[model samples]
Target: MNKHSITLSFEINEPQLLLRDAIKHYGISKKALTSIKYEGGTILVNGEEKTVRHILTVGDKVTIIFPEEKSSEGLIAEKGDFPILFEDEHILIFSKEAGLSTIPSREHPHGTVANFVAGYFAESGLSSTVHIVTRLDKDTSGVICVAKHRHAHHLLSEMQKAGTISREYEAIVHGFIQQDSFVIDAPIGRKDGSIIERLISQEGKYAKTSVQVLNRFHLQGEELTHVRLQLHTGRTHQIRVHMMSIGHPLIGDDLYGGSQKFISRQALHARELNLKHPFSGETLKIISPFPKDMKDIIPTKTTK
Candidate 1:
């Protein structure tokens, strides 16, 4: 009957403590909080579902849509493109480019892979069930897996949860790393008046990434290392955060470290993946070569 609702924004230097204070002040459940994660929700700093506990940093914006008395829900959408990598009776893997979201979120409503893929399926006269098992950030590129049916979706998702799926990434960081390989084992959570950007937290989720030096190149005489990263545990911004922690932040990761970029999106790609077939029990391994943008950064083997 009334359209009046509370819309308040708070800027906090210590977001975690302030969020704790806000919850107490407003007496709202943690779930009612939009996009705030506790090393927490799967939503990201840019407003995607990120699974990490986040403590607020200086000048973080916390917006509260306030409590709901009662509510109804609907799935409304707009459309875009869906690049098909491989598809079969039940499984579909796609080459999702930078600027395409793997699924739906409050922040990226229009330019998402899900909406695009669903539309693509319709044009082809397919069922268009389009069940996404995992998601990539709006600016990250490469392979994403989805299911065409609910049964298939649940099975593959379960396998992913059980550690049966292997995902690998490629990134160009802003420095030359000496180690042939390194592992980043960090627990992450929320920070700032925001809910999505993750920071180290003992109360955070388990995230591990292993990186191997792929090559080194010069940009304006400054050398930057391109790396192949493997994920042991996937968390919000795992590669971006891990690389930043090691002083080799991604070339175009403005949130982590923004420098040394040639592309409009983050210079990260999900280059390879391995998984077990949800229904057939067959092992599936998929690899994607560097997209033209990422490939351009490296010199030919003869040149090096």
Candidate 2:
């Protein structure tokens, strides 16, 4: 097997179960099974090739070999130095910095996390393509998740839809928030005539963000509040829009009525992520420390 291919084996415990049912029970999608059948892959029972319809008795061993994957075209491999929080055969977690795009775009075609990951994969001789499961905004620094294969990507996507993936962010906003904790339940939609901006509207999709005030301090004669935010729904600019709607825009977030008095980018960092490992079914909690720009503004006496 190549570096990009995966082989999984299981001991059948139930009697007279179809191989197809067993595979499905193990979380292999029908599309993936179809690919294994048509593509260069194999399924074996007791060390012999077998069809999906074959009956499996207790003590039988089932093995599946997945086809090798290919990297996407036009995804150039570029070496870069970034912090890798955790990595395994199934997934890679990165502590990305600000001012770097997560993936290539029309405006930014290089120096992205995806390009760096592609370079790493090439150096490791793995043909798997870049599959980013969780992406952060260009100006937001935080923890990002990348899947190493298509099966892991599919499972992570499903986990996201089921609300099993959770993220927490720490942000410094423009004003002193009086509330200790609150939830901003609003609808977010694309702003009219602008593809990059989002606004809270009645006709928009449901979005909820819970906010907790961490500290209130004075910086250069301006009142600022450090807050921790938890996202209950994934929406474009949801945290920015929700914070702005509550009269406290993020510091340096000029697009959302904030001023860049002390910081260069939005003073937001993805602080924590909680999720289950797709392959091992174990809970994984990853964290990213505050970047230098944001950390410098906080008082030395205050704790994060």
Candidate 3:
């Protein structure tokens, strides 16, 4: 078992309130309380261990020690130079690099973003669970959020399902886009006879994407359009397939008939994220600049 502990301390606000009620009032879950009772956790009042049934007065200092989570199976924490944009008690925002999968899969289980985060948590002596709130494609680079514990994870997941978590992306497509701004409203489903590829079909789930052209220029005699995209509904390869439907696939995306002359992977980056914090209720807007490979693929006027 891991030796580190997660401790939370606060003063009681109501007089004559029981320890369990105070904990619940402070947003601690009933399941966590059960863990404290059965999993060697501790509860203290004014530096002395107390039961949840004990009563409390105003300004009484109460502390709860949460034990370490047992190490999960098949997760080998490996350290790396992770780019952290923001971190707090509840969550973390990381700028994920290209070529790294967000989580482990059957074929490639190690060197994933989750493994890197586990390593960071271990090195920091933290015992909290690794909870990824947002996942990006393996070749996609940009900001992703990770919850430090289960409560935060639950809140964020609820927000995502409610369509409150907003994400923006940037990409360089193969052809110039004529419209300044437009939306793609279509349904997406697994391509027939293919397990991975997705297509636009009537018998698919609803998907919407908003696109705005940022820059239109020529690179090496090939017309390229730099565009900003907002996803109304998350779908596998939504942007890529939508753009392909309009005859402008992402640069270097071989699956959608894009050229690989400029870059080896898809020219897509999750550039921005906006959401409300689970605990603080404060708005968070995180942004990440384009990676070198993408920047080089869409050169500015000065370089051209």
| Per-model TM-score on C-alpha atoms | 0.70, 0.96, 0.81
lDDT (tens digit, per residue) of candidate 1 on 111-158 = 577777666655555543567787788788888987764445656766
User: For residues 115-182, could you state the per-residue lDDT of candidate 3 as single tens digits?
Assistant: 99988988877766688988888888899999887657766887888999999999999877889899
Q: What shift in Å separates residue 237 of candidate 2 from its native position after superposition?
A: 1.1
- Judge candidate 2 at residue 253 and give its lDDT: 97
Model 3 ranges off by over 4 Å: 1-67, 302-304
In candidate 2, list every pair of residues with a backbone clash: none
Q: Pick by lDDT: which candidate is best?
A: 2
State, as a TM-score between 0 and 1, how close model 2 is to the true structure.
0.96
| Candidate 1 Cα lDDT to native | 0.68
Q: Return whichever of 1 and 3 wins on lDDT.
A: 3
Better of 1 and 2 by TM-score: 2
lDDT of every model, 2 decimals: 0.68, 0.91, 0.85
Top candidate when judged by TM-score against the true structure: 2
How many clashes in each candidate?
A: 31, 0, 0
> What are the per-residue Cα lDDT tens digits for candidate 2 across 80-193?
987889999889898999998989987778999999999988888888889999989999999999998878888899889889999999999998899899999999999999
lDDT of 2 at 48: 98
Give the Cα error of residue 280 in candidate 2, in Å: 1.6
